[model samples]
Structures are given as C-alpha cells and as structure tokens.
Target chain A: MHTETPFKTHFNAEQAGLESLNIKSSNITFVSVSDMLALINQYGVEQLMLGMVEYLEADFKRWLDFDKSPRFAAHSAEGVIELMPVADHQQFSFKYVNGHPKNTKIGLQTVTAFGVLSDVASGYPLMLSEMTILTALRTAATSAMMAKYLAPKQSKTLAMIGCGAQSEFQILAFKAILGVTHVRLYDIEPNATKKCFNNLQSYSKENDLNIEICHSSEEVIKEADIITTCTADKRNATILKSDMVGEGVHINAIGGDCPGKTELDAALLNRSDVFVEYEPQTRIEGDIQQLPSDSKVTEMYQVILGEKSGRTHDAQLTIFDGVGFALEDYSALRFIFELIKQNKEAQQIELLASPEDPRNLFGLTQTHSTPSA
Target chain B: MHTETPFKTHFNAEQAGLESLNIKSSNITFVSVSDMLALINQYGVEQLMLGMVEYLEADFKRWLDFDKSPRFAAHSAEGVIELMPVADHQQFSFKYVNGHPKNTKIGLQTVTAFGVLSDVASGYPLMLSEMTILTALRTAATSAMMAKYLAPKQSKTLAMIGCGAQSEFQILAFKAILGVTHVRLYDIEPNATKKCFNNLQSYSKENDLNIEICHSSEEVIKEADIITTCTADKRNATILKSDMVGEGVHINAIGGDCPGKTELDAALLNRSDVFVEYEPQTRIEGDIQQLPSDSKVTEMYQVILGEKSGRTHDAQLTIFDGVGFALEDYSALRFIFELIKQNKEAQQIELLASPEDPRNLFGLTQTHSTPSA
Candidate 1:
C-alpha cells in the first residue's frame, strides 16, 4: 500500500486546521494522463461515468447559481484554442482546451485539455488535472444524463454516427446510465468503425451488450432509440439529414461545436424540439447556429430543474444540441477533486508560489547567493 | 552540470524532425516558484527585467497582430478570478490570476497566478509557469518600459506609495531600466514600509542607491521624479490627492485597478495625461475608470510604435495607468520559454494526454486489466 504522500497529508492537515499549518505546504493535486488511466483501471469506466452523471445532474439543477459566459476562443488557420471558465459561490474552475482536426495526421489527438480548480475565498488553486480524458468522460456523462430526462424510457439501442475517439465512451455512458445494451456504429472511414468494434469486444461480451457496424448513417439509426452525431469536420457538413432521423429518437449531437462547424442538417434542427447546454453559447457554436437567432430552444438546465418539459410525448422528436458548457467542466473537476481525497497517492505538483512572508514576495529570489555574471 | 532531461531531449528531437518523432514524448515545461527563483538567481533579477523590457517593447510595437479581448472575470464576495487570454498568429497565451485582499490575513498571498503558453499552429501548450513571481517581474518591467517613453529624460528619484509586495520589484526595475538612483517609500502600515526598506538594503548598498522612508504619502512624493501608487485596498480611497502631485513627475498608478477599487483622486486623473494598455479593458478596470467612458486616453502601443507622442516636455504630468494586459503576460511567458531552452534542467510535467492511437482513446484504460469491484 502506498504511504500517505504530502499531497494527502497536507490536505488532511489543512482540514484539521487551515490556520495551523504553513500555507506554503498547500500544493495543487496534479492528475496526469497516466493517473487518469490508473483511476479508470481502479474503478471501471462505466462506474466513473455513473458517478459523473450524478454530479452533472446535480450541477445542472443549480445552473442559475453559476457565472456563465461563452468560451474565449483564439481561432487560427489550423484550429481553435479555448478557455472555458465557470464558478459558483465557493469554487471556481476553468478548462484549457484546443481543437485541431488536422493534428491526427501528425500523430496528435484532435482535442487535448487540462484544467484547474480553485477556492473562491483564498483564490488558491486546489487541483490541476489532465482534462483530455476527463472531457471525453464528462461529455458522454452529460449526454446520457440529458437523455435520462429526454430519451424514450428504457432506451436499449444507440446509433453512433462518428465512430472515432468519442464513440466508445458515448456507448458505455449510455449503457451505464440508461441501460443501453445495443450499439450500432457507422463512420465515414470504415477503419474507425472497425477500431470501435474491436475495442468493445471484451466489454460487450462481459456485459452481454450487443454491437453492430453499419455502412451508412441511415442504416445505423434505423431502429436506434438514440442517435449520436459526433463527426470532426471543421465545416458545416450535415452528417445527419432530416429524412434519416426517425420519429421519437433523441439525437445527441456533440461535435460541430465551433462557429463554422456543425453536423446536423438545418431542416432537421428546425423540425426537432431543440435542447442546449447554454443558450448564448449554443446559439453561436451548437447545431442551433444554423437556425435563426430567435429560434425556439430550451436550455437543458431548465429541464433538469423541472422548470420546462423534456419528453412531452413518445412521438415528439427531441434533439440535444450540446456545445459543451463550462459548468459541466466545473462539476467534473469538483468530482475528481473529491475522488482524489479518498485516493491517498494521487500526484501533487508545486504550481503556486507560497512565500513564508506573503507580503515579501521579493525575498524568494534571495534564497540562493550566487548570481550569474 | 545537469544532464538533458526528457523534456529538452523531446523538444530538440521534435524540432529536428517533427514528423519523425512520436508526438507523445512532448511534455509541457513546468516552472515552479522555485524554478523561477532559480532562474532569477542564475541570471540576476536586473538582467532578467532588462531582457523582459526588450521583449515588452518589441511586442508592443507589433500589437495589431494579436487577437485581444478583455479578460474574463468571475467576481465573488471575497475577490475575483480572471482569465486573460491573447494570441498572435503563431503563439497563444493566457494567465489565470486571482486577487483576494483578505487572503493575507490567513497567511496566503493577496494575489497568485499561473499561466500557459501554447503553439497556435498545433494548439498544444508548450509551457506552464508559476506567475506569482513572474507577474511581479512583468508588472514592474511594464511600468519601467512605459516610463522610458513617457518619463522626463534622466530622472533620478522614485517615490513608491504602499510599499508592500510589489515595491522592491518596482524599485529595481526603475534602477535597472531607467537608471533611477534614489528611492522614497511610504505605506499605510509602517511595518510594510519597514519590510520594504529592510529587503532593499543589500541591493541599495551594492549599487550606491539612496533610500528614504516617509510618514505620509505627501512627504514621500516631495521632489520625486516618479511616483508609483500600488496600495491593495479593494475600495476607492484616494491615496494621492491632486494637490499633492507636482509637474514634471511620471506617475505609475497600478493600484487603482478593478471596477470599484482605485487609489488616485479623480482630480489627479483629470490633471494628468493618461496612457494605458488595451483601451477597451482600461476603460473598465484601470484608474481611468473614474473618468467618463469617452474620456481621451492614449494606448501605449501607439507610443511604442511612434504613432503617438509620449512625453512632450519636462514639466508635463504623465501617468501610465496600467491595469496589466494579457500581452505583457504573453511576452513574459515567451521570454521564460526561451530562457528554459538554454537551461536544460527546467522541470516538465505531463499535463496533456497522448494515446498511441489518437482515435483509440479507450485503449488507454485497458493498459491495466483489473477493475475495482
């Protein structure tokens, strides 16, 4: 068993009495990619997603308490880099993420991210975690949590239109949260579908879940209770046409989250009862960007809070146009912070400056005598 | 001499042949407070600030190339946390900073910060650094750099009001960049003034710089060539009355930042020729916030580019109302990135995820077989 590292020891000491210990010992818990994988191994991916859904649902219910804004994005010729920040009364969190579709050609992930969680009172960061994997987890958890209130009851089949990096996570989240046992996958590249199918072999057998591969999106969603479109095109390419989506199917559109990027046909969006993570942001980056500015759409928080209707009838078409909100990242960071508290050996990094005398910041430089000529 | 760690090795290998190397080996250069102190000790604070001034001047000249926006702020009862992001065509940078005045009461610094520098082409972060110390350095360097263009020629004395954490850095920056040899300090708390005076003893002695402490802000500014106000009060209290300021003095007013927090009297602001960094932001957060929204003020970049006048004559009252722009942080991070390249032993952290197959993100969890019950 791993001994209590300074990360946990300091946290425990602080919890005992924040004023007793030297605040200099307060360091940020750092969750690397390897740490995240270790965590997933410690608790299965399905269980983590199940845990995350509760957080997502709880945070969404109190959405009005959060300070929300559209992400700050710096778009270049290649892609975009964005900073998403949201905070409640006690804690503040922000995620630094980037999207470059062309990165995979050079053997890099299309989207990579990291984030910080901080205390609102003292303004000191509590944790810094690798968010690429966590983002995939949270995105899926959010989708499945939304579908719990919006999808058909006991939804058993999910059709994933983009069988890329996010396909497996989406399938597992639906399985863990909504009892989705059948997954149908399709992609523009057949290799993506093959990879998705190959990855799920062991889990599918163990959990008694059925998996199938289809050559076309139309064929994939033929009887799917829920359809997920997550293609990575940087332009307004309609991967799902209005005629392809069947009645009463909840569409989970996750990709097409940038200004010029979208996945669903505008006509399909017009016909469905659209729900979004945050209206101001989704108006610019979500599939609703293709619709008129004044088009009718419901913010998902209202549905979660029981202020608005989610699934009015079995025949009503519901579409979740999630552009990804900052509040979800805040909840994910908050959840991970709690998990690390229980796991003693989580890594910590010296990310902040803690001078013995807080006001004498200049004294830190005088510690070493030798100065370079 | 320390050996080349995996950080520099991977960076070099990527530079030599980006397409040939596995991009998974790339990691972010992590500069802790200790690392920053090591850097300051190695090169000396004066030399580092001098080098930073050159970068600041060069960047300010080409300011139009940057994608700039007002910082995103989350304000609470205790304080505010802000994300300041700016990017050029090739590089992107942002700083995460918070200011809680009451933090010092609990033995925490009033302000703490960290930031990320990234490649705009790939949207991958290149470096992550502790900005608490660097922010002090950058803030001083920006003030002195502006004083170079705006201050009266060959000024010798600097009077600093509120001799707290930033006092010593401001004094050194003036000494190194503008050749100021005399200093006068005053603070509301006499102990803060004593602390500042004690900290600067060795540097003053070594460089033959004269130092004085005054009981009142009025006495401190007497015959001063430059006056700097940097009190940390969170309210609009006038530390400098208009009648107290004299002509031919360059005023560096930095404490009067944020919406309701200010230090200079409105009459003093009305009497001075104010120059600022990034006008849109200054209009909300700088000392100029006391003035009307349409009040005339010069953006400093234009002066650096020689498009506008700086100091017209010796008797003119000029003020650099700097609220700390994102561009300065960009320049500071860029400078540190270059410095760490020469110092091979700089620390690195695994802040980003790099799966072997970018599309097979699910495969990462499979590396460890046993799942918790």
Candidate 2:
C-alpha cells in the first residue's frame, strides 16, 4: 500500500482525504470563541456537560486500543507549548496548547489551544477547530466524570477556589452531572469574582442553581462537598492548605500543571487519595509532583476500568489532580468532529489540497479559483 | 492581540509552506510534488541541489541556538509513525512521517510525509507543505554536504546500491556538488535497476554523466569512490561486506535508519571511521546499532565545526551514516517558506481562531461569515 504513484497515476496528493479510501477534499470545521458561547447557550451547559461525560466514559473504556505518544513540548522561561497526539486504528487527533502564565498580564488568557482530527490511514487533517473553549468544556466534563464514579452520592455543594474563565464551566458541569446545587466561589482578584458572579447569574436562573462569590478561599472550602482550585499563577501557590480541606471534600486541582507551578500544599497531598490521568506524565506534570516518586496514586484508567477503589470511605478526601491528558483532548476532538460532521450549521473549510493528479500538484498555481480543505 | 475577528479567514492546511511573520495574518506557503518536479525541471537538478546545500549548510552552523525536542515516535506491528520537532527562536517546524515496508504492496510509498512551520509567539501554523519530494531532495542535498566536508577531494565514481525513488536525487546531488561523473548501480531487483536507469536517461546529456547497470554489488563497490545504500528492506541485510569495501571510500548510509534495519557489516564499522547526525538518535537508528553503545563516534556538527576529523588519513574509509535529522527539515522548510514569501505565492492561512472577544468563543457558530484570527 506504500508505493509512489507511477507519476502518471491520477493519485494527487492534495486530493487525498482523511479516509485514504479515495481522494476527497478535507473539510476543516472551525469553532471560534463566540460560536462556542452560542453552542453552550443553545444546548445549555447542563446538556453539554452530560454529552462530554458520556463521551469520556466511552473513550476511556477503549484506551488500550489507541495509539498513544508522548506529547511534544517546547519549554520557555515563562511557560511551555505542547502538542499532544493520539489515535486509534482509524482517527488521529492532536492538540496544540500553551501555558503562558504571563498571558493574563498582557490582557490575554493564560492558555489557548486548537486541534486537528484526521484519519490515520490517509493522513489528511479532517478538522481544524479552535479548542480554547472546547478545552474549558472538556476539563470541567472530566472533573464531573471523576465525581460520578468516585464522589459520594447526594453530593450537592462545591467550593470553587478560583473563579476565572474555567470556573463557570466547572460549576455548570458539577450541577449537570453531580447535582451540585450551590457553588461558593473565591478568586484573588475581586473583579474576577464579580465577572464570574455576573456571568453565571443567567445560568443560575435557567438551571435554578445558587452561586455565591466568597471573600476567601478558606471560607469557600470550609464546608463543601467538593473543592476546585483553578488558579493561574506560575509560582507555587498554596491556594488550599491541608487545614482548609475537609474530609469527603473532593479536590479538583486544575492549575498546578507544570513543574514548580503547583497549587496545593504538599501537606494536603499526603492526606488525600490521589487519582491521575496518566501516571507517567502526571508524575511530572500533576499535583502528584508534590509527592514522592514511589507515592501510591492510582491511574484514572484503573478507576475507569474498575481495577481500583476510587473513594475508600465516605469521609475520605479524594483529590482528582487533573493535568490534562492527550486522551481527553482525543475524545473531545472526536466528539466535536463528529458533532460538526452531522450538523449542517458547522461550516466546513477546505484545508487540504486535492488535485486531479497527485503528481501534477503544480497545476494548482495556474488555477484562478482557490480551494479550501 | 488574540481577539477573534468579526469575519472569517481561510487557507489550505496540508499544502506546503514554512513559518513567516506578518503583522496582520499568518502567511502560509505550499509546494506540492508536481511543483517540485516542475521546479526541478525548470531550474535543473544542479541548481536545486546547490540551493538546498547552501541552505542546509547555513542552518547546520547555528545548531546551538535551536530548541530541539527529540522526535516523538509510535511503533506498530506493521510500521512506525514519527513526529520530528525542532525550532530556533524565530522559526519552528515538525514533520509527520511513517515507515511501512509492506505499503509498497498496496502502491504507496514506504515513507510519506507532510509538515507545518509555525510561529512560536502567536501559536499559528504558518505553512503546511508536502515533504515527500522535498525529503528526497533534502536527503540528497545533506549527503552532498557531507561529501563536501568528508569525501576525498579527487572522488570520481559512486556506487549506487538499492536504486529506488531516492537513487536519482542522490546521483544528481553527487554530480552537482562533488563533480562525480560516473555511477555504477546495483539492486537485487532487476526492475528497480531498469527504473533507475530509465529515470536518469534525461540527465545524461546535460553533464555527460556515465551510468552503468551492474550485475553484482561487488562489481559496483570495487570501482566507486562513494557508496550510498538507499534500500527499503527492513532487515539487517549486510549488503556491503567488510572485505568488499575499499580504501578512501565515503559511504553515505541513508536506508538503514530504523531499529533492526541496517545495510553495513559490523566488521565494516570497526574498520571504517563512522560519523553520525546525532549520536543519541543514531545509536538507536543508524548502522552503528551493530556496535556497542560506548563505541566512539563523532558528531557531524563536530566535523563541520572542524573540532574533529572528517577524513584524517587518505587510506581511511569515511562513513556518513545519516538517519535524517529535524535540523535538515528545519533548514529545508526555512528555504521553501522563504521562497514562497519572496515570490508572492504564499497566502495567510487562518489556523487559530483568535476572536475579538476571547470569552465569546461559543458565539462563533451563529456568525459564520465573521472574521477571526
């Protein structure tokens, strides 16, 4: 199957589709930030959260069947840029993400991302979607997925320790998947809390959920069923100390990703039961970085696969230390790729060149009409 | 700066180009296989070889400035797919390549590749290019550059082993750079010999180059000044025995690039002075795989910088065991990306959707005609 076209064979490289079965142009489906807000509004965050949870459960069950590779990371003084790649026998997906903590200083979000979904056989990229919004949606959905399997039944209150762009997504996901009716929010910046408070007011009315912005992280974490810290600082910030974290309080640590950029105090990690996406990667990138090399933390796959206990007791402090996995982005890309493929409103952009003669790709320059994916 | 546009911007993703800077939009350039063939015929192979060598040499000298990430690879029962990433402070490039020997049975090239050049600052893919044909060109050009620094000054003839798609480029590169006038070819398949012979018949007139089809490998090895093994077999064939190798011959070993794939005898490595692209990678991928880990080998950069010897003795056999490096692709991409930019053939590809309102990504679906970054 790996022969160069006999120069004369009508095997145009540009015309090759993602399927590789025949040459069809690729359709790059794009989702901008604004479109994402509209999508969330139309379906409602509750429905989006539910959709994501179901997708993650299905994707995780087939984890071993997929082709997984270590992410490609470029380290800078300020942050890191990474490309995470994953594929099964058919679909290939990769996410481009950056963790520049200084971005907020310049009026930009701390992280931004986009992704591609392609066919493994043809190697044609089928979708190029903006993933900044999708990432927020998926991360929240992942947290809720963990809560469904591990959190105590009838969990209803959540203490959100850092209310930012991702905080609302987290709140909505919990409300949708875990039936958390109330959220107590806290942020370093007072305006950030106001923004979360004002933005979530409409969501509160629609879902009949209650949200209160708190003055301190300690006050929010005092008596909640779940605690989520999504701080964006580059330095090691102890947003949640051991004393603040109570029993049976699931800690959804979101921001402590890179080395030396942890959020939770090491004291809390020692007392809590930890779960990670991928052990090898999480060891270097998750809140588990605070723990020893030989620390006994279960891979989330084990929990998903039912090989290990998630919450041993109703009073255990369970920490879902998520440091985003390639697999989650893999599932998200496929979900959106399939979503847009079925919907007529999802516009298709031509990104790959599919010519009549793969060998005669030079003839495209002579044409007046521009081709899309 | 990352704000999404109120309108949409578009471009092809898989077409070829490299990272280019612009204040407004991301400029992406492309070169398909036919365009390369067109350029090859128009400029002639000599000029393309010369330009590639000049560009490759420039990038090789500034090697320390690059942020080099080791290539990520995924192996399978049938073949392997690898992602090679490298970047200087200004430009970044990555190539996706797959090696499957059995692919020939289905009429596909054993190795097929495409790549993107992106800007580090904005996180935009500026160019996507077809690298299959360009890979052949760069591989040949890299060989020529090696011979220029390593080969004997009075080299006249080259032994062509395992004549394939790469055979023509290698021969032409040698002719253009080393003034090699004669090539004696050998391949196990008679059909391959016929293909190589027929392809280069047109080049014979321009340079008065002589090509002889030989019956055995020994026949070609005895008289040639350089020997290039561009074979496709995945096994350790030991095509060139230690005893058959002559003195002062510069061996360009290109085909024995993966683990378990080698063309040279182990004894030949002990007898010949071995030089590699990157020692860490070559240890696992090159002909030196036959040798022990501690066995000393010089880096090509050291030889280029004159910190180590290339050919210390007239009688010593010198080998350039090249498993293609990311730097070569970086240089090749820079050259092509610049070419399209200068010729005004490149266009801005809207890859990342940076909206006016970073928080409103969900509103993009309703505004289909809206512009974004």
Candidate 3:
C-alpha cells in the first residue's frame, strides 16, 4: 500500500512515460523481519537454503569480480557496529550488523542485521531487508559449502558444539546441501540444549533425522563426521582440543569471529589444514586470530575455483575458518532480491526523492512567501 | 501502518513489559521526499536554514569528538557512488549518495542521496530519510556559515555563477543568513537562467530585493560582494578566472566537488587564501586537488573553533572550498530527527525486526512440519 503507482492519474501520458523512464521514483522495497519469516514459510527453509547456497557458490566462484573490503567497524565499550559494502559492475550491496554478546542477558538479540542492495548505475536502493535471519541461513550455507569440499566422502553425522541461536540453521543447511541425516548436539548450558531440542524435535521427526541431545561436547565429538563449533563466549576458551578432534573430520568454526574470541585450542588449529573465506579478514577475526601472523592458511575461493587441493587424504583434518565476509551477505541479498522480484507481497516504502525536474529539488516542497527577518 | 505494535493480544503482562524496555520495535521513522517538502512548507525555509546553521556550528565546534574518514567511492564510466560514514560514542550515521552528471539528460537527477542514523549501543537504525532536498539545504547553510566568517562584514550584493539545482538554495541561504538584498545570476544555458529567474521572482518581490538575470558571467562578476560558483560540469572548468575576481570578494566554490570536477581556474586558487573542511578529503575532491599536497590551507573547523583567523583584511581574497562532508549530512540528519521527534506526522516505517525472544529468529516464520528434499 505504501508503494507509489508508477503511473499516477494526475500525470499526462507524456509526463507519465517520462517519469517511468527516470527510475528515480524514490521508493525501495522493505522486507521486515515478519516479511522474511513469511517468505521462509512460503518457500520452505530447505528450498531457501538450497537456493541461497546456489547463489553463494556462484558468487564465490567469481570472487575476483567483486569489490571486496573488510567491514568498517566502529567499536565501543558495549559492542561493535560494522558496515560491509561490496559491489559488482551492475549492483552494490552493504550490510549493517552488530555483535554484542551481553545483549542476550537483557533479552535483546546478540546479533541483528539489515542490508540494502542498490543499482550501481543510479546508486538507488532496490531492496532493503531484515538480515538477521538471512545471516543465520547464509552462515550455515557457507559452512555446508565448505564441508562439501573438505569433509570425508562418507560424512553423514554433524556435531553441533554450541546449540545457540545459529545451531538450528546450521543443521537445516547441512541437511539441505550435504544430505546430512544425523546430528549430535551439545551445549555448556543445559537450558540451551533444551531450547534447541524443543525447537528442532518436530523437524527431526519430519525429515527422518536422528537428532540426539548429548550430555557433553566430548560425547558428541566422538560420533560426528563434521564438527561445527558455534559457542557464544566472548573469550579465548578452548571448546575443542587437539586430541579431542578426530582425523578426517571437517571442522566448521564460526563462533570464534571477533578478535580475542576463539573456540579451538591453538594446538588443534596448528594441526588442521585451515581454509578461510578471506585471508586478510580471517587472520584478524577468525579462530586463526589466536595463531601467529605468519601462520599458513588456504583461501576458500581457491578451493572452490579448483586452484587448490581439498581433502587430499582420507585421514587429513580440515578446518573451515569463517568470519562471515561481505560477499556472502551480497550473495544472500541477491538471493532474497530474486525472491522479492517474483513475489509481489514483498512490501516496499519510499526512501528517495524524485523531483519532476531534478533541478527543482526545493520546489518539491513549495516555500512560504513571507520572508520573516 | 507497517509499524508493529509491541503489545499484541498474544503477549502476556511480563512479555509486554520486557518488550517495552527493549526499543527494537522494528519501526524506524522514515522521511520521504514528499514528507520533507511538507516539513519545509510547515516550518518555512528561513527558519529551517537558521536552525540548521545552529546545528552545523555546534557540530563543527566539537569536530574532534567525531570519527572522520574520507568517503569510500566506487567510480564507473558514467559516474560515482559513495558511502560516507561517521560516528561518535553514542550514535552512528552514513549517507549513500551518487553523482551522475549525464543523468539529467534522461530526466533523472544528477545527484541523489539517502541516509541512516542508528543508535550505537544496540546498532538499531532510528531513522531513514530522503537526503536530496536536505543535502541542498545543508550545503547552502554550510556556505552561508562560511561566508559569515570569511566574507566582508558589510557585504550586500551576491553574484551566483552557473544557476542550477542548488542555486536557489544558495541565494535563499545568503538572504536569510547574511541579509543579502540583491542577487545577480548567470549560466551557460539561458533556459537555466530563465528557470532561476522565475523561481525567485516572487521571493525577490516578497523580500524587496533586486533580482537580475545576466547574459554573461562577466556582467554579474563586476559589482558583486560575494560570488558563489556552483556549476554542474564533471570536468575541470574555469567558470571564474583570476582577473575577473576583485578584492575582498568571498568565493564559495561548491560545484568543484569530486576528483577531476572543479569550476575555478588554478590561477584564481593561487591568488586566494583557501579554507577547507577536512584537509585530507579536500585534497582529493575539492578545487584544491589542483594544488600541491603540501599546499597551505586553513581548516574551516579551526576558524569556527577560534584556533585560526578569518578574513584578515578588507582587500584579502578569501575562498571557502565547499566540498560537502559526511559530518554535514550527520548534522542534517540530526536536525531532521529532532523535527520528527517533535511532530508525529513525520511518518515512520518498520525497517527492523523484533521478536518476543530474540534468539528465536527462525521461529518468527514458523516452518512447515514436512521438510521436503
């Protein structure tokens, strides 16, 4: 209802035609959190995850085509707010996300994000979306994509180390992308495990997945072919040790993203063949931030592009160090934009000004004649 | 209407109280182009200009409190899109703007802009607004603020070079701020001059001022006290030369923004004492881009802060290099946010998501029981 009709009744045909060609109508599609939820319901999570992974893989293959930059962060005492902007020749995308570990204590989300995709030609925003849910999906998809190349061929069971906000998403993505059937879940807090169990119990029954809630992380680690560590701690606490991680298992380490916040022991990271989304950003924010600056790591795009070897030996351990790059958000935005294009129910709101004569910008607001001194 | 009421019928008393404490209501005040126009119509331009100047001065005086960076720009064959971000401890702001000089040929705006202001604590956006009209007003206010300090105190008449989209705002700003009673306008295209003449003819009559449309820039340049050059060409243009400028005449060079886009001759710059906002950024985008890297320039903030002098002598030629900065947009956004706060009619839309339990983001969109592969 908020959208302005392209052809207004007041405009003459020539004026309407001219206005239609301008492409500066000052409106952008706005997808609220509820709208995104509705989209997921309509399309189904498996379908959305599968579609998102396809876009992510396609974008990652052409990594060099994108204008990539580390997120510009404004760190404060409480949290950090970042702007991650990336562009291709035709489109530009940016995500505004925050990381605040203590927000959960006060019943606020620890992480919340929103993003915009604009046309490069006019720099006019085409879509504005709630990215909190989308980020969870993309992060899970990125992990699954990495596991597809690096995990052992017969991998079927996943070890979910944290069982926090992103645990269900990771499980769902693995199921959709890798055909993963079994999941072993563990969390330091028993209530977190209960929440995860309550949320995904119906999912497990419907999908024919063997979901087990384990008593300890070690119990789950022994059975997992793929290990995903997504703890919410803000310190360098070792949730996985070098000895505990088995050979041939692919480790998806996501929770250890900020500097000084890592999940794996240094000894474990030193032993594994680590792959990263972007080396420059991962070195500073990923689990490898605990490693020495000169530590060797493989870029994930190279593996995807077939320039580097993946899972060379049956017993070799692989680690996917994901700090969440800007390009992944770009891919997610592109995916959602495509969906919105197909669905007319995606609501839009006016955000820009399109004056009939761009030169008469002030005339858009007619002025008062009394020039009071 | 897009805004979500925090207390839905489903919420219990405790949940409603908790939701009230957390300000993540998914609603953000949005000011559209039409809304901004209505605001101006209600408040009057002179009043808005005066208030904006006050906010601009207040922000400039405490310049060190802000985090400043050169705008991040993406250039193409046609034009450029830029992201300018700035923040303090409590709040963050960014502007997405594009400059496409050829756009007007196709009935599109040569420049379009929008911006966001968010709370730094939670990283939630507070407002989204159409910035094209706001930018025009703020640019004119900044020029007027500079002219008050740099121009001769007793100056009256004004000469406006290259009458375009921003010309009327500049004239009105001078009239409101400096009590300038006369304006002489010139442009390469006679139609542009005619448009300017028509727009301000009623304004001149209301304020009892002399308004002249000259055939050439020379006719206006000879008798003006303050000269403002605001051409829209995207190349190095000599709209004003050294011999044409007189003693004690203040020069407001605004059109010469962005690299390789300038209006004044290098010789004219060489003869005047140049003042700039943010030296490092001005070196790349302003008229001073033609000068040496180590060229002596006074920071406008220093002049505002009383750390440096302004307009030393009656015959001194002073130039205020008016390259728009992120902080000016910040000031503009702050001003608009205040007005919206006072008046609820300034419509806001839901741009973020708020759930009963922040951790259950996926729960917002309830998934189907059957997970089809």
Best by lDDT: 1
Better of 1 and 2 by TM-score: 1
User: Could you give candidate 1's per-residue lDDT for residues A1-373 as a string of tens digits?
Assistant: 0112222222221242223223355477788877788778877788777777767877887788889999999999999999999998777899999999999898888899999988877878888998999999999999999998899977889999998888899999898888888999999999999999999998899889999999998799989999999999899998999988779889999997999999999999999999999999999999999989999999988999999999999988999998999999988887777777676676777777777888989988889733121
What fraction of the true interface does each of the listed models get right, in terms of native contacts kept? 0.70, 0.05, 0.42
Screening candidate 1 with a backbone cut-off below 3 angstroms (N, C-alpha, C), the clashing residue pairs are none
Lowest lDDT 10-residue stretch of candidate 3 chain B: B1-10
Estimate, for each residue in B1-373, the C-alpha lDDT of model 2 and write its tens digit.
1122121111223222233355223124445444444455545556666777766776676777778655776666677777788876656788877776765555445666667776555444566666766787789989989988788877889899988767888888898888888988988988777777776776677569999999888887777889998898888989899999878889999999998999999999898889888888898889999999998798888778778888886787988999999989987776666555654543444444454334333333224343232
* Top-down DockQ ranking: 1, 3, 2
Report the lDDT tens digits of candidate 3 across residue range B1-373: 1112121122122221112223557677778776777768777677677778877887888799888888888787678888889887666889888898888876778888888887776777788888888898999989998888899877789999988889889998898888888899999988888888888888789888789989887898877889999999989988898888888889999999999998888888999999998998999999999999998899999999999998989999999998899999988887777776656455666556565677766666564422110
iRMSD values, candidates in order: 4.3, 5.9, 6.5
Q: Per-residue CA lDDT of candidate 2, range A1-373, in tens?
A: 1112122212122432343333254334655544555565556556766766666877787778777655778776666778888877766778878776665554444577777775555455566666777898899999989887777667888888777668878887888778888889899888778777877787689778888878988788766888888988877889888887768878889888877778999999999888888777788877888789889888777788898889878888888888888889877876665555445676554444443433223233234443112
The deviation in Å at residue B295 for candidate 2 is 1.7
Off by over 4 Å in 1: A1-26, A369-373, B1-23, B369-373
lDDT of 3 by residue, A153-272 (tens): 868899999987898899888887777789999999887777777888888898798898898878988768899999987788899989898788899999998888899999999999
Best by TM-score: 1
Q: Which stretches of candidate 3 lie over 4 Å from their true place?
A: A1-22, A367-373, B1-22, B367-373
Q: Chain B TM per candidate, please? A: 0.93, 0.90, 0.92
